[model samples]
Target: MQDNKIKQEIEDVELIIGKIMQIGVLIAGAVLIVGVVALLVQGDGGYAAGAHPSRPLAILAGVAAFKPYAIMMLGIFLLILTPVLRVVVSIYAFIKENDKLYAWITTVVLVILVIAMLIGYFGK
Candidate 1:
């Protein structure tokens, strides 16, 4: 009947959403791994430290010369954003169905990413 068809469609949609979530988790994991590898491959941040410009006012121009610094900052931002997005998604998922494990795992990954980013950012 019409009710059965609607139920089947809902189930299909849920299945697709679940697959997308799994893919998202994998992507986040991959980004974390790549960030670690980058840290290891490039010591000293893999870019020139802020160099003094010829002009006295050039100190503020460090952003232009510090390519690695910019990249590092971008990675750090991504690390932070990932967790924030995960939290939002996790809350919605929790509302639909009370599951804490996914939220916890996302949080743990976020923490680790933040720590690694800090170490890399400061260690540079």
Candidate 2:
């Protein structure tokens, strides 16, 4: 009985995680579409040849300025962020289930992901 209950709860958590991924992807796709439409209407990407916003602040500023490339980049960033969000949700779900081993494992994975992102951002 206890095992069945735990399994059910885990299933619920998985469903929530699936929904998160689905929504994230959908939103990112929509943003990308909007950016594409804007680019087409404007007849330009609004950036110099070979120039693009690489930093978060620059991206945000460009997005605020309604730059199509920045909007598309934001969409790409959100797409990349979706799986990382899933890992975070998994960590919370594991901790909630009192599953110490899985919780610690997920935490380590999250840490590694953050480290990798930092390295990539800085190495650029």
Candidate 3:
């Protein structure tokens, strides 16, 4: 009975995580579409060629300025972040299940992910 309960809980969490992924993708796709639309409205056949700020904060600033590439970059950034968020949620789920090994593993994975992102963002 206890095993069955655990299985059921895990399945439910899995379903929620699936929705999170879907929503994240949809959000990113929508943003990309908007960027395309902006390009269309500007009468440019495509995005204006130029350097887009790679840093997250800089990207946000550019998005605020309504730069098409920046909007698209923000979308791509969020798309990447979605799976990272999933991993975070999984860590919580693992802790709830009292699964120490999996929890520790997830924590390590999260740490590594953060480190990588920092390097990507802050490194030249």
Candidate 4:
């Protein structure tokens, strides 16, 4: 009985994570589509020649200014973030289930991901 309950709870967590990924992809795709459509309608890339915002704050500023490239960048950012979000949720679910081993493993994975992202961002 306890095993069955644990299995069921794990299944529920999986379902929730699936939904989160699905929604994240859909929203990211929609934003990308909007950016593409705007680019097509404007008949230009909407950025200075050979230049686009690469930093988060710059991207946000460009997005606030309605730059199509920034919108597309945001979409890409969200797409990349989906799996990170899944890892975070997995960590929480594991902790909830009292699975310290898996929770610690997932936490390590998250730390690695963050480190990689930071290196990628600042390495440029």
Q: lDDT tens string, model 4, 55-94?
A: 8998888788888998899889989999999999999899
37-119, model 2: which lDDT tens digit per residue? 98999887779977888888888998999999999999999999999999999998998799999999999999999999999
lDDT head-to-head 1 vs 4, winner: 4
TM-score of structure candidate 4:
0.91
**In model 2, what are the clashing residue pairs, if there are any?**
none
lDDT of each: 0.53, 0.92, 0.86, 0.91
- List the pairs of residues colliding in candidate 3: none
Q: Where's the lowest-lDDT run of ten residues in candidate 3?
A: 43-52
Off by over 4 Å in 3: 1-5, 43-48
Assess every candidate by TM-score.
Answer: 0.40, 0.90, 0.87, 0.91
Best by lDDT: 2
Q: Sort by TM-score, best first: what order?
A: 4, 2, 3, 1
Ranking by lDDT: 2, 4, 3, 1
lDDT for predicted candidate 1 compared with the true structure? 0.53
Once model 2 is optimally superposed onto the true structure by TM-score, how far is the C-alpha of residue 64 displaced, in angstroms?
Answer: 0.7
> For candidate 1, which ten residues in a row score worst on lDDT?
51-60
lDDT of 3 by residue, 11-91 (tens): 898888899999999999999888788867775523345566688887888788887777888889989999999999899
Q: Per-residue alpha-carbon lDDT of model 1 for 1-124, expressed as tens digits?
A: 9768666765665665566566666665665565456656665544456642222223224334543434444444444455456555554454344357765776676677668867865675
